[model samples]
Target: MPILGLKAPGPSTPAHFSLEPLIRPNILALQPYRCARDDYSAGVLLDANENAIGPALPSASAKKVKVNGHSDSNGTSGASASAEDIALETLSLLPPGTDLNRYPSPTHDELKRRIAHLRGVPDENWVFLGVGSDEVIDMLFRVLCVPGKDRVLTTPPTYGMYKVTANVNDVGVLEVPLIAEGGKFQLDEDAMDEAFTANPDLKIVFICSPGNPTGTVIPLPAIRRVLENPKFKGVVLVDEAYIDFAPSNSSAAQLINEYANVCVTQTLSKSFGLAAIRLGYLLAPPPLIQILTNTKAPYNISVPTASIAASAVSDAGMAVMAEAVSTLNANRDYLLETLPTIPSIGDILGGNDANFVLVQVLDGPKGKVCNNRAVQVYKTMAETRGVVVRYRGGEIGCEGCLRITVGTRTECEEVIKQLKDLLA
Candidate 1:
């Protein structure tokens, strides 16, 4: 079958894969609901029937909330600085003429352009904005999978949300566990191929790079092998939520320009430090992007979220993110080195390519990993102690493990301090 031949589709140009067939017919033929700000944003006086009186927030502080994303004296994004101030008084201002009384731009072209530049994609045409990667994931299932008929493939010990979303959509999820016994949390290409061959009807495969709970990146060559497979014709969704912490070459986004079957979802919630705004996007071929756009809600993103996200992905914003990633990577290294010094610590899993680390808590001060003690440590740290780290001991290949986020120097010290006292 030349459908998804095992060779590169063609080195000259992107594969001419027809996305219409991949998308649900209803979505492909969808007549998107035109939003208020779709046509004219300049002279929109009275079109969408918005409240003429403007927002209820004190206009004095509200208008002053304009989050100028331009660079600060420190050469970092001003918006990044402002966002870090969690105090309620730091109300963000809207973009010029971005009236709170009116709806936000449906396309968010400026935001898409920033994302395109950041991802090194051709242009905004290659981007699809979503409430978060969760929205993108849910929509992928909605537009690609048929309820109770079609299914998606996922690697175990990855993100849990993929399965939860699958269940919510009533779609079957085929689990192919990563090479856990190897202690690397890497993709098992052979098992994955077998699963794809067996489940020929699968429509989507979720590859969580810099995998959640694992903190390791799946190699791009492995991803290419999956994409080029003649048997699996489904779309490959690469979740790169933590790609900022990894080397640039590790991103699956580099494959989007070449592979029609590949899509990458990213977010400002992580390295960009905009989790409160809850923004994420997908980078894919224009056809797939159009399909997602058509199927998405007309006004999915709000005024404030778009403003903040646009700034976060801006040139200045990216610089800030780079510096932040560097700091976190250093902290991750510190954790990897220090966690072992604690008594009863076993091997630390994953590549340490993310802002977090997964460490195995031992039975006593040094032998084999003990899941029970790890659970106890997790609870005590959260309740008894003033710190909170995720308990991933129950996850596959992560038995007796705790997932710790690399926090500020003081916060990390507190975690290490608590672990030492508790385990001692």
Candidate 2:
């Protein structure tokens, strides 16, 4: 029987596959990032221009002392560092095995194993480890979106990276603002449906639960609605970076096996307390994993990052972190209940589920009051009371709002004290 006319043998037949058409034509023609050599054999290496005989980058110990205020040599601080300070400190440390002059592992296998075991996801389903969750978000746009031709949908007052990545990739962003009625924000299904209808070619839908800025979790039923829509054939990226902070468990990892179109991205930066390690993960179907791997830069994760991240995911580490998260949640609750008592604060976004809460400042007679006032308050609190919070406004709908990450119990009490003084 001719193969064209006959039904192929099921499972037993020899499989033949070609990736020529599946890859984007543009991506196939693009040149990837070229760094150091891939091989580590005993030989003089000088291909990539580097100071072969120079002093190495600053040690982690040195960097830690400069950045972290604590007396510990490991750079771990008793108090929280500002995000910018943390980023600067992390950049000071060189990649692992720098003195050995050998190339690190191309795939970060050990890290993957630890992550897989910790997350309960099979190793095969993850791909494209990057410096942060932002990198993965960028990669998702690069792999799935056609830029200008395709679009992605996100609810505003969410993580700004989804929009920023879309803009950087030259992809169109279709935003549907979440409903902030009755002093609580939730996913607006009607707006989502309308946006999807308007943009049929949307290749990705970015949903951050216990959403950024808003700190609202998209309801499970609402998520199911989006996934079940036949019109949504493209990938649905659910960013669970802050999910560990939420009261409820994450839906992204749990729904992965059920929905082929769903892909969940997470980060160690948030809950794992390994923000300096620059590790994030994606949980998707094997096919999507293959596509992401094919498109991602080779050796995207460095050895030190992989090593520390894997260590951070241990059972004991997770237990300690869980306690920390609980403490933060309690702190968040304290702030939520207490902030409203002071005047000038309007509707709050996110409720019990988030690690942070969004406080909307009511504008006075001055034309569209400045939200930076909250930042000013934050700065004063940081300097006087040693408490720091994020100011997130200046977006379309986030006017006069401040994003406050929950701190330790004592730190939170200090914050409350400072805010009370400011309000008074």
Candidate 3:
């Protein structure tokens, strides 16, 4: 199979880097399922078995409001409504022309175009959308790795999904631990090179930048080493799910044009506050993007999702997201400054580049990091104390650590207050 077999339009891809050879044979020859929307989305009398009489919901104007403890068709009140009325109110949020009966566009190019522009990609061809980053992860595995044969290398204490998805696909995972010394949590380049040499058959290398639990960004130079490695020919997956909170110029999306084997995954779940919409996208060279696009479900993204994502990546949406990220970053800073002041809190680990802080929970004011204490505090906060945070005391280099997401000022203060009382 040749990379040229797929007519992907973009800048000149690396001549030495061919995607087909690394892809599963069956996938290379797959005939993508063509949907009706792919052909025409215009005036349709009878196409794709769509209901001509519109969707099964009342008109948006039919929504009612309760006023003075009486049912009114207009105006607002504090009273709750029946299930039907609630459904109507939710449906009203959709555009007046949303056709739920019809299938969504297989290639929502406009949405992709906006996302491409936001991510600094060449064009929509360089992007692929999935239900979430989880789907993007699964699709990469589906297209590249052969079940029970090929393997992927992941950094420990990283996003669990990379390993989980690998396991779900019957693929083996190779662990190369990140450098935990000095709370750096960075990629150990030499160890990764050794793994590549030891496992030449590995199909993908998953690196979670602004890493989960660690919240540290793997600098671009470190990533370049892996990409330029002579021992590995597989794709280098950079999961930037938390990239929004990291410092500027910290993304691997910039490397796609330079390296054909690099793929970057991002989601609207975090910064955009659109997790319910379940939109995630991947940025890569056209060849790999095209293959993953062809392998995904024809209508994996719904019309509502596309609409929501379009608004999210729009200029106004970007402004709103930027403001939110700024606030969260400030909150994260507050945690970094305040967590260490608590009596039993030890050194806060990682770079704190993400929206969370990973801090060690000590047994007493001067005691060592204690897993039992961390677990007790975590359980107490969630179950009895009405506050919640993750206990990552079991992860590599994160013993007796609690991964706390940066929250609003009040929430951040409350957590600090709770920790002080509990540790006291």
Q: Which candidate ranks first by lDDT, i.e. highest?
A: 3
lDDT by residue (tens digit), candidate 2, 165-237 = 8888898888787786653567778877777677766778888887777777777777877877755656678
Q: Mind giving the per-residue lDDT tens digits that candidate 1 earns over 1-424?
A: 1122121221222343445577776666776457765566666478878898877654334344344543232323445554334322234434555667777778888889878988888888889889888999999999998888889999989999999999999999999988988468888899988997788777998999999989889999899888888678788999999998987799999998888888999988899988877798999877677677778888899888898787777778888988888888888878888888989888898877889999999989668899999998898888989899999988999999999999987888889889989988
Better of 1 and 3 by TM-score: 3
- Model 2 accuracy (lDDT, Cα): 0.66
Number of the top-ranking candidate, with TM-score as the measure: 3
Which wins on TM-score, candidate 2 or candidate 3? 3
TM-score of each: 0.90, 0.76, 0.92
Global lDDT of each candidate: 0.81, 0.66, 0.86
Candidate 3: C-alpha lDDT: 0.86
Clashes of 2: 0
- RMSD per candidate (Å) reads 5.1, 7.2, 3.6
Which portions of model 2 show Cα errors greater than 4 Å? 1-23, 28-100, 362-388, 393-399
Candidate 3: worst 10 consecutive residues by lDDT? 63-72
Tens digit per residue, CA lDDT, model 3, 310-329: 98899999999999999999
